[model samples]
Target chain A: MPRYRAIIAYDGTDFYGWQVQPGKRTVQGELEKAVNQMAKNPEIPIRVQGSGRTDAGVHALGQVVHFDLPYQIPANGVRKGLATMLPFDIGIEQVDIVADDFHAQYSAHTKTYRYQLSNREFRAPFRRNYTGYWPRRLDYDKMAQAIPDYLGEHDWISFAASGFQAKTTVRTVTDVKISQEPATQEITFEFTGTGFLYNQIRIMVGVLLEIGMGTRPVDDIPRLLAAKDRQQARLTAPASGLYLKSVDY
Target chain B: MPRYRAIIAYDGTDFYGWQVQPGKRTVQGELEKAVNQMAKNPEIPIRVQGSGRTDAGVHALGQVVHFDLPYQIPANGVRKGLATMLPFDIGIEQVDIVADDFHAQYSAHTKTYRYQLSNREFRAPFRRNYTGYWPRRLDYDKMAQAIPDYLGEHDWISFAASGFQAKTTVRTVTDVKISQEPATQEITFEFTGTGFLYNQIRIMVGVLLEIGMGTRPVDDIPRLLAAKDRQQARLTAPASGLYLKSVDY
Candidate 1:
């Protein structure tokens, strides 16, 4: 069996998430179906593991997945075959042959996640479908100032989504960035880290937004981190704004 | 009543066409509903007349439409208000008050229509939803060489869609140009004319494509036009590639 690594992108609107679930549309399910059809034996099972298990309606630009093929096929041939078989929205952006032991999810070194905020009264017709439409003014300078506070390793129990279970909450965030797009009303919160807990980016976005909306002060982020309780965290932002941008290995 | 002209852009995947139809999701119908909601009068009876009637799944960037408003509203206000009430894929690109005698469809001096062609074997995941995908290789030089033959006054009867009935087949094409996007697998054909018959641009694209694909000669365009029969034309290109880019009034 030859192992292949594929970079994928999806709209995430129709899909439940990246994981495979019975009777649900998912990125994992779509890719696996295509892989199985191409395999020499129809009965042979092929499982794909994604770098990030994104939540429902969360999109990705650089989602990495690994699957083993029963027969060796050129990477470009596999790409074309998958493109022909996959649905219009879910597509394999790039395919490459990898070492047999290479695992897309496990071998990932760092992942960059982005949460977008459209701080405008009216949403751009083209961008509204994918971004969160926030009809409020934001103090971007204050948001940028708060970035360094969340940069180092910390226990993010306060930012975890409801019912989120993890072995440990201590995670190293290498960088935290808040920036605005040129000539647009979009504000993006980018985080590069070793890994992330469930819904942590969205929760942090909500807290930053609360600060933007004058409901919380810039100093409150540190206090909230110290609280180590989900109750102290602001509301979770919508999944539409979050994107797994890239995985570095 | 004050008549206003609006420039529009849309992704036609979800729309039936530009005309108002019963039991179909049409562009005119959506605009009419939004107008009625804003005008707030049951008997106002606003009909948005389009510069050209596009077929189902055809996109538009500068489609012009006119409607009579019983009461005066700021142009900017109407633009913003209608945009807020409408869906994301449809938008008012421009809105302004024109002369009382102005008609969107009839008062135009010239119109420009653009058709997109995907020039690669592998399809893009995000673009497949909006653009027509083809697997065949295209010769841009041959297509570009053939564009000028369709430039001047002539009866473009053969280039119209089957069963299309317009009062006159004689039309003056101002210019026809083909260009490629830098570093992308997208080709664009822009056609400018004083007026175009129904489905004229689409059929021209088809003939151009057939020539590029080695199915027809570059000189076949004039030969088909001389035949003056709709059956002599090549296939009517898919609607996904056609766009009503602009209208000059």
Candidate 2:
């Protein structure tokens, strides 16, 4: 058997998530089906391991995955086969043969996630699926002033959803970038960190949005971090606006 | 009765077109339903007139329309009422009470249309419904060189679809602009004109795409215009990429 590493991208509107479930349409399920068909192994399904699990309606630009095949195939052949077999919304960006030691989940060192919001008077019809709609006016400068609070290491238990199974709630966040397009009124928030707890990014964004909307003071972030209680940050942004931007190993 | 003029936007992927048919979903059909609901009229359906008809799957950014209501309603009231009644895919941008003589179709002085193409090695799944996919490298400069021929008045018979009911194929195109985004590989073609024959913009974009792909010479545009034969420019681009950008009164 040979192992292969691949980069994948998908529009997650129609998918349940990145995990394989018995009766749901998922990104992992579709990828595994394509891989098994290409290898002509209908008796068994090859398990594809993703770097992380994304919630339903969460998109991805550069998701990393690894799988073992029953036999060896050329790198380009594998790419073409998977591209042809998978659904139109899921795209196979790159494929390469990798060493047996390259585990997609364990070998990842850092990951980046982005959340987008449409800060317009009304939601634009074309962008309904790709961005979360925030009809109220947002103060960009206020949002920018609060972004630095999310940097560095912190116990993100307040931002994490209940029932998350992480060993520790502390994670090192390396960077946070906030940008807004004046013409389109689209605000994007990007976070890069060593690891993230379940629903942490969406919760953090919800806090930031409240700050932008003037409902919460700019200095409220530190208080939320100190509380270390899930109730402190209860608003979780919609999954449609969240994207797994990249994974670095 | 009071006349109202409104600017509208929509995602046309699920619509049959702008015109109303018995069983098909259409933009006009939805707008009329919303207006009549507001008017509380069950006896007869109010007629909504669009600046022009758009083909199926063709989107709009600033499509103009007008209608006469049986009773008076504030502009803001009408806007909010329609917004609440209409589906999420269609948006009412602006509304104003206009004079009784105002007509959406006859009062228009100029209309601008845009056609977009994604020129990349592979089709981006997320942008499938918004742009036409051309999985080939294109020379933007070649396309730009041929855009000047489309400016000024010309008989666009070669670009018009068969069975068009326009009295004459002659139309004055006031301006043409071509631009490309290097990062996203999105090419946009914009044409501002006094009027357009049926399917003219899509046909012209198809010719421009062929020129950009090196299949047809840049100078081939003049020959096609002179030929005045519909077969000379038979490739009508997909309606997904066409947008009625604006209408000026």
A-chain TM-score of every model: 0.96, 0.97
TM-score of model number 1:
0.90
Candidate 1: list runs displaced more than 4 Å.
A115-121, A135-149, A176-189, A207-223, A232-237
* Model 1, C-alpha of B32: deviation from truth (Å): 1.3
Candidate 2 C-alpha error for residue A151, in Å: 2.8
Candidate 2 lDDT by residue in tens digits, A1-249? 799999999999899999999999999999988888888875777889999999899999999999999889998899989888988788888999999999998999999999989888767888887988888878889999999999999999999998888778899999999998989889999999999999999999999989988999999998999998898788888898999999999
Error of 1 at B203 (Å): 2.3
DockQ leader? 2
Predicted complexes: DockQ each = 0.52, 0.62
Error of 2 at A164 (Å): 3.8
- Over B1-249, each residue of candidate 1 has an lDDT whose tens digit, in order, gives 888888888888789988888999998889988888888855857888888788888888888999889988999998988887777778787789877899987788999999887776766655765566766888889999999999999988888877778899999999888899756688999999999888888888888889999899978888888999878775777788888889887
Q: What are the per-residue Cα lDDT tens digits for candidate 1 across A66-170?
A: 998888999999988888788877767799999998989889999999888777766555565578888788888888887778888888999998898989998
Q: List the global CA lDDT of all models.
A: 0.85, 0.91
Please provide the root mean square deviation of candidate 1 (C-alpha atoms, Å): 2.8
Top lDDT prediction, candidate number: 2
